[model samples]
Target: MKAYRMLTEDEVLQLKSQSCLADDWNNVLVSSDFNTAYVHHTRFSGNVKLGSFDGEFTLKGGIKKHAGLRHVTLHNVTVGDCCCIENIQNYIANYEIGDHTFIENVDIILVDGLSKFGNGVEVAVLNETGGREVLINDKLSAHQAYILALYRHRPELINRIKEITDFYSNKHASDKGAIGSHVMIVNTGSIKNVRIGDYCYIEGTCRLKNGSINSNADAPVHIGYGVICEDFIISSGSHVDDGTMLSRCFVGQACQLGHNYSASDSLFFSNCQGENGEACAIFAGPFTVTHHKSTLLIAGMFSFMNAGSGSNQSNHMYKLGPIHQGTLERGAKTTSDSYILWPARVGAFSLVMGRHVNHADTSNLPFSYLIEQGNTTYLVPGVNLRSVGTIRDAQKWPKRDKRKDPNKLDYINYNLLSPYTIQKMFKGREILKELKRVSGETSEIYSFQSAKIKNSSLNKGIGFYEIAIQKFLGNSIIKRLEGVDFKSCEEIRARLKPDTEIGLGEWVDVSGLIAPKSEVDKLLDGIENGDINRLDEMNTSFETMHQNYYTYEWTWAYNKIQEFYKLNSDEITVQDIINIVNQWKEAVIGLDKMVYADAKKEFSLSSMTGFGADGSREEKEQDFEQVRGVFESNPFVTAVLKHIDDKTVLGNELINRIGHLA
Candidate 1:
């Protein structure tokens, strides 16, 4: 609400004397504090408004420059107070520059006609051949895009989401662009139809067109040298630097894409890091990191994934266009030089090694490994449940989150064993038991989904899945009865009952948020029926689900307890609870011992081969200890031992408490 008035005749003359020219002096309006002494060597046209330039800016080396317009051309622009606009190679047109900003050595910044600032751009993510186009807007979240891309079967729901996005885009369409306060745009080229936010730093960027940098004071964005971006919306706390190129993309909060990484028609959600890699039409969910120069991720949907060096995927068989796509569920990892033919689905927390041509689907067998030998795909199920690397990955993801914005777009769940993976393990156990029953228990190998599982692996998988299931269910029961003072068997049974029925049946991982499938369906129904019309309301619904996760999880676990233990909820007694608690104690101790054993392999003799080069065996052992620490004293090993001790005490305490009720 700044007031502007025409400059006095003497002020106009003084400005002219200071080497400033205007098409018509009457068209230029200035604030009360505007001084002719600070305005020099500038040309003004097309109804320009100038604010007070009464302050000076201090440089890094204690140099001071008075805030004013110098050696620049402005057309239909309003320059705010304390801003220094200097050395513009071409005119800045139709922009409202904010206070305390510095724009120097820029070429041609403008808003042409009416622009939506990339709000309505359709990003063809997940499937490269199109159809799964998420209309990316400023408020787009990973969970929203997940539904839009993969829930194509619900056409009405898709149309509703598109309508909401289109409405948002149209509402924000403007004829004039804006640069917020405290922004610095230096040595940039051709910024057209872009809206830059507060505290943003843009330096040496080649071109940025039709985008919105949603930066703020709390979480500023930095776009650095040689970066070229088009039709994108980069959220707060992100850094795009070092010759990176992106087109038709929506980068979420705290993401980093740099070092010549190139992406086209993709959606990268929160905390995703891509350095020196190329991605095309991929839906990179939260924490999908690819740091290799030779790795190419295309036509895939991934979350909490890590792609190793030289890892690649094929999107076509060469007969048709590149129409195939694949999904690697959360926490899946690919080893170096690994390859997977598209139209496949790898389960959650699975490790992939070598190359495989067959389209194997291991969605029911999580925490496993898919290794290739002599071109044959071998499935080792539930082995990753005991891997030290898997535990470390689970422990590190939450610590690695870099989003500083208070309003995070993506809702991430960091639990390694939730209802989502536990359900898969439950099905995996059933599938293994069925295989053993059908193939005479003595079969050499069992074939499933074009992959082979040896008899030993199958039996071991059953045992592993059972242990994990017991652990999860036991955890739920113990937590449910944590502070309850149940003195009788009836009170224990009453306490064991679920509070709600919302978590029965199946659950899904919507990007990172894990919730019941029934609830997700209800949300989709609301969207389809026009009950949920705004983007904010949809995000609010997701937040509600995230907030009530434990409540819903207890319901699912309650139902599974009855089925797994063959008990009726009303007729259950304290003796049944004690038996379940005893089994849980054994499961917890068994898994911890397995993890301890797996961690010991890292310090084995074979792992010390490359250590202590140019030394004898004793020296090699010494060097390995110096570099990697002793096996008994390593941090992860200590944590594992502590976990074992804590869980053992917890199980015994719970068992003793339940025994008193009997």
Candidate 2:
């Protein structure tokens, strides 16, 4: 650190000649190479330090009018090299401006008092009033925030986590604000108690109060025209532009908030896009996107979810103060004009249609449709299992991950069928069976969790869940024995055995990361015991669990093999393998046919209504075919047919292998 030095007597006289005044020239210090040639029409107040201005910077947009610092005051400020601080309508006090930064036509960039720049701002996510407030920080991940917001019942765990977050916040607390290197704050209004990071673009922003724009060179944040943010931490690579308003929000990596979208007390994780919509007190985990103007997402937890136009939720019953909340689990979708009453839980990959007053909880029955019949909520389970859109969404999420930064805060798992949903399927099958058992199986309709399930829907749901279960287990068994050349039955049996027994039981989807319930419990226990104190360490545990998913999945699948085949592992015959293979082949083909039939609905006459706007029927058919290629040649259809062929060959090959042993 260089020693602070006062301006020379001659320099002070030269500044006096130029009508510049300093509160005691001794209070102002500058680097040895600081040039007074560029310090024209500038005033210094309180304690100020100036770095060397020897470095030249070529500003973007070819407006090189850099020799002005008129009508601006600096206090206890350290101005770095090549920074043009001009037309600051109000003073910039207690700040450190970095090199190559352009601060032109800005109003009041100041740190009024001791500020942490919104590091420890508590956001009451689920419950609006209080009780479950998450202390947001620079490194807050979705999993950490999830646990902190939802697990408030365990006070000790919450306190321990809060203490850790407080420690982090205290470590970052500073007496002065910082404007990082290469930042441009041109034509902005009112930046108070905020920290601007490196390479950030804050142009024409209305106001930024008490926040941290965590922009960097790799993924710079762009706060464009009319943006207003308060008590926020916008992570790297995000764009908050075009009249967007944010309050008490944690905008995650590579997320886009634009086009008048307003969010308050929401946590939007990686790759979440909000355009022309409004979100309030929502926990938007990774890839929760809503681009419709009329959509309003309030008081919910969602991930990989797409909200259709006019899709909304009711958080108030006119009794309590907006107390109710809902959970639309991962990959859940809503059609246009769809509505759900709060205190509801829609399962993973489920599709919701129309308005329903009944607060249905279908958390165990994933891939279902919750449709409204008259005023009744009708639940159809496992129908979305073969949906091409579901598969396409799963495939697209990974490709659309926009985080260019090396350090990813969110750990997202994009598997369509994991132990998380599979375990739910297991429970869902039991729940349906129990529904039938209780209703006598001959009932016309069954009631469950504020929703009605028709008799045919119940039977079809059971069949679908069974098929999915068998498919998953058979897939695991086949994968386990994929590369192994089993010359004998003993070798095949040995190969089928799981490497580890840790993943035999229930599984959970903690936001995006899917792991066995036992593992999550261990992590929570670790946090409770002060073992997993650091946030990074906790995230590493999550990563470890995610990495070991396949291993644990095999363990769970291996245990279910005997139950599915009705053969004890100790007394297995070669015919058991043949029987399972034949069953697997049947399930695979059956699902394919259903998917094919579902795909055909897309090419129906009803689907061609809007196509060929002014054309005859023949032209309409041609236009529809031209726009959406012939069904036989469609990629998904071809893939389905090829899947049938491949599975047939695979089953026949397995049967042949078993026949040799017989």
Best-fitting candidate, measured by TM-score?
A: 1
Runs off by more than 4 Å, candidate 1: 60-63
Write one digit per residue (lDDT tens) for candidate 2, span 1-662.
66657889987888777767787799889878777776766778888888776555466787565533455788889988777787888789999988888788888889988888989999989778877799999998898898898887789899999998998898889889999999988899999999999999999999999999999999999999999999999999999999999999999999999999999999999999999999999999999999999999999999999999999998989897899999999999999999998989999999999997878889999999999989999999998988878877887999999999898888889988888888899899999999999989899999997899999999999999999887777777667766555688888777777889889788877788888889888888998998987878888988898789888888888788877677777777677777777778888898888888888899999999988979799999999999998999999889889999998888787677557886
lDDT of 2 at 284: 95
Please state every model's RMSD to the true fold in angstroms: 1.4, 2.5
The local lDDT score (0 to 100) that residue 3 gets in candidate 1 is 91
The lDDT, on a scale of 0 to 1, for candidate 2 is 0.88
TM-score of 1: 0.98
Q: List candidate 2 segments past 4 Å from native.
A: 1-6, 10-19, 54-61, 65-71, 570-582, 633-635, 638-662
Model 1, global lDDT: 0.93
Q: Report backbone clashes per prediction.
A: 0, 0
Q: For model 2, give the 10-residue run with minimal summed lDDT.
A: 62-71
Positional deviation of residue 594's Cα in model 2 after best superposition, in angstroms:
2.8
